[model samples]
Target chain A: MTPDPHRAHVPAVVHLDHVTRRFGDVVALDDVSLAVGPGELVGLLGPNGAGKSTLLSLVAGLRRPDAGTVRLLGGDPRDPRSRTGLGVTPQETGLPATLRVQEVVDFVGGHFPDPVPTPELLDQLGLGELARRQTGALSGGQKRRLAVALALVGRPRVLLLDEPTTGLDVGARQALWDAIREYHGAGGTVLLTSHYLEEVQALAERVVVVDRGAVRADDTLDAVLRRVSLRRVVLTAVEDLAGRPGVVRAEGAGDGTPARQTLYTPDADALVRDLVTTGVEFHDLEIRGASLEEAFAEMVAPEGAAR
Target chain B: MTAPTTAPTTPPATAPPLPAARLAWLHLRYQVLETVRVPIAVLGNLLFPALAMFFFVVPQREVAGDPVVATTAVAGLALFAVCSASLFTYGLGVAEDRQLPFDPFVRSLPVGAAPQLLARIGTGAAFAVLGVLPLVAIGAFLTEASVTLVRLVAGVGTLVLASVPFVLLGMAVGYSLSAKAALPVVQVLLFPLAFAGGLFLPPQLFPAWLDAVSQATPTRAARDLLVQALTGEPGSAWAWPVLTGWIALLAVLAVVAYRRDEGRRFR
Candidate 1:
């Protein structure tokens, strides 16, 4: 049978209506339902063994689900058309280590019709000079870049990236974020799994937090953090008060040496002003709120905390 | 000094479409290229057989004056050569491919399982060509036998057909064993099958039960056909039907093993 010729124009790229997967007694995915529309970059964030990889495999047609349905661009997971519409970057760098970088990319490119040109892909990922180098010769960060490049070469409508920045440096990580933004800007959809909460906050407009094989929180980054009500505020101490109420711990100048004391409190301005009135002087005082890391930690802490 | 970074350039907004056939053709070519990329496999599949023929079969012929026995020896070696190249090269290659993530990509592509299997068989047939060509040339030039063009063509055809059991045997071996154990398993089976099939000695020297057991061997049946075609001896006609049956049997085994393993991968 021939594939549908008009799938390239569809807007909603991936729709997992109610997909559930079980490995023997363990439920890898529990009645998970999600949708990724065109021009969207959704982050699937969870700790190890939280079934992030299994979810991607189901969408990529690597493994079948035990119950429910997963539809990619209006076709079943195993459909040839569905597969062609999607590209995947697995956590493990899956390239043949012995092959030249160019050859490995070329080989994977051969699997898809109308793949991006080799030079274009090389230049985009800054791998132009390493084309002739064997994959085994690449550094850990370079290997991860090649893995990302392999997935992008297909110009797929929906991209599934599992820990795309696992071993990358800061610059490399931002460059990947820019590339992902560019893809999204051009109307491609992406579903990524990452342990870096900062990365998810920076790149993904929507996030899904799965814990114990179920969706613990699924909403915008701001919304989920708000749902968990986890907050943090750092204060620069102005007073040398030996004892204080409502302060968890104070660091920096309890003995009156010349260092700033940081106090953790739910109330920020009240404690700072009280210390100032009681013969405390302060400079460069700053208050910080809860980070995504703290919020996520609180959300999944009941499942024995995310390592 | 700091490294200078270049600005990223995207492909122009529009490029032409790539036809579907081009993709499938490239996949097949890449698969075959990677299958034979190893130097050890190349030497084992091509060089080892030629070396065995030179040391074991050719030297004996130089000492013995009987042309008939030498011709039978060449026929048996040809059969063993086909088995070695197909079972060793194609079998182990499939096992290695299974360990890779290639199956996910293969399933993702527009190509079906049938086309992939056909590509593997084509690769096996290519290795067969590399392993068998030298023997055919040397046997025709150095030996006294029925080396007519028709007979030579038929001999090559029988040798290629004899690869069925080997290819099927490879699929089973490839599926049942890990990559590390595959080569050793192939090594243990190769000599036994070759010896039982009369590649090392003529079937006449064996006892009655051994001869009957040899008659059941696919290599023995195939070697007999090659010997009959080469030496103009029509006495071993029973070997033809028996070899064809073994070919069919091995083909069934290959398909079963492949399907079972493939199902496991999907499940």
Candidate 2:
């Protein structure tokens, strides 16, 4: 049951067909297939060791799959020629320790036929001031920013960013997202992976949730979120309401008058109606749509799906 | 994904990458920059041979006062300098870089490993030559080693040629072992090779049986050739064959080690 089965017809910049990869007896990727069409910003959402990095390695030609073929820009990924237009920021940042920031940028850019000018690229990534500083002297966040800048320096047609902002603070993460958005704005194809569901929810037009080395759900962001029907209802009330109508699960604060409670249900509308009609006096009632957290959980653990 | 506003376009046929030689030169330039910034690392290669020359050769009148003896000793130590520099520079230097995340990213670049690898060789050679300068200065200034201009140039060329097999050997070790293990291995190999090759002790001092055995080793063969280049006297006929044999053998081992490393990391 593959999503976008006709994806091959569109001439994908990156395409993997039934690829399987293993380490010793451990299967890293199992019969997985996917494609990224030109100019699409696809988010690969998965938890740690879900084979997200493994998939990128296959496309980047750093590793070969035990089965099936992978193509980059219509050429075999292993061929250096095929990778000329691709830029990648792997999960770990590794700039030469003694090389200055600008030198690192210049060195990487030199490999490409048409590269972004060093000064402009550094300034865009907020690294202009650090150009003369050695990479080893930079803070962790600064090194990460430089890594992303190196990925962009080559003016590549495709960018593959693995866990691009996993450990970044909110502000840093947002800034990187904006940089990615700018690239997307210019029609650069991006295939980024993240374990943070909110990261996918924030930037991805399409979400591909990967778990246990297989595709769990691959669809438009709205469509994936729509699968989540369990709305959250929070209120403070005097009565016990664990088994209220339309509520599938409920938790309450330790026994107290006017205790706080949260109810999860399929229909907040009917639940609110039942609460009012039943003469339950509750204050501070709040209703919100189902979170991507629960939606992702359902996708990964199908039998427990609320819908 | 936000549906594209402009039409989706496939990447054009890839442009011709930077010329391979130019890329290799650029790689060498940065590699040199990286090494130059670390003064101590370069100093290690330079100081050891110079210290040996100063303490052992300069103080010994019989070895340093006689022209032929002094010149051969200088040549042998120069070869030792090249050998030591090649081993540690490639063996430990490569192993250390392997520990860094940057090494793999460089390996993944589209220009392929040739440019980077060639540049590493150039960097190692540059520093190996730098390592020799102090020893040369100490021998020239403090001792009576003398050579014609032709022989002087020949000795330099021979020293570079003699470094090849050791560089290959270092690469094999570098690729095959982690940094922690590689350091001890390179040290253990370096000291013994230098001693057995008669680089420290004169070949004539070696017992006949030991001298024969020494001639078979790359280090001894390299030392003998270096001595011949400087003294204009021929060494045992085994020099070229022994050196050539080690070069061929280590060359294969180096290639095997490189491929094995690639397979282990990427496959």
Clashing pairs in 2: A205-B1, A206-B1
Predicted structure with the largest TM-score when compared to the true one? 2
Tens digits of lDDT, candidate 1, B87-108: 7765776777667764554555
Query: What are the per-residue Cα lDDT tens digits for candidate 1 across A194-279?
Result: 88787887888878888767887778766754554433334444455335654543445545455555554545567666766766
**Residue B259 lDDT in candidate 2:** 51
A1-307: candidate 2 lDDT, tens digit per residue: 1246466466888888999998888788889988888778899988788899889878887777889899988888776788787888733456777889999989988887777778888887788899999888998788878888878777777888888887888898888898888788788888999988788878888888788889887888777666555788889998878778877667674365888887877789999999999898899999987676764565576343434
- Model 1 off-target regions past 4 Å? A1-12, A24-26, A90-92, A232-291, A301-307, B1-24, B35-37, B62-65, B101-108, B137-146, B180-198, B201-217, B228-267
Distance from true location, Cα of B2 in model 1, Å: 26
For model 2, the docking class works out as acceptable
Error of 2 at B237 (Å): 3.8
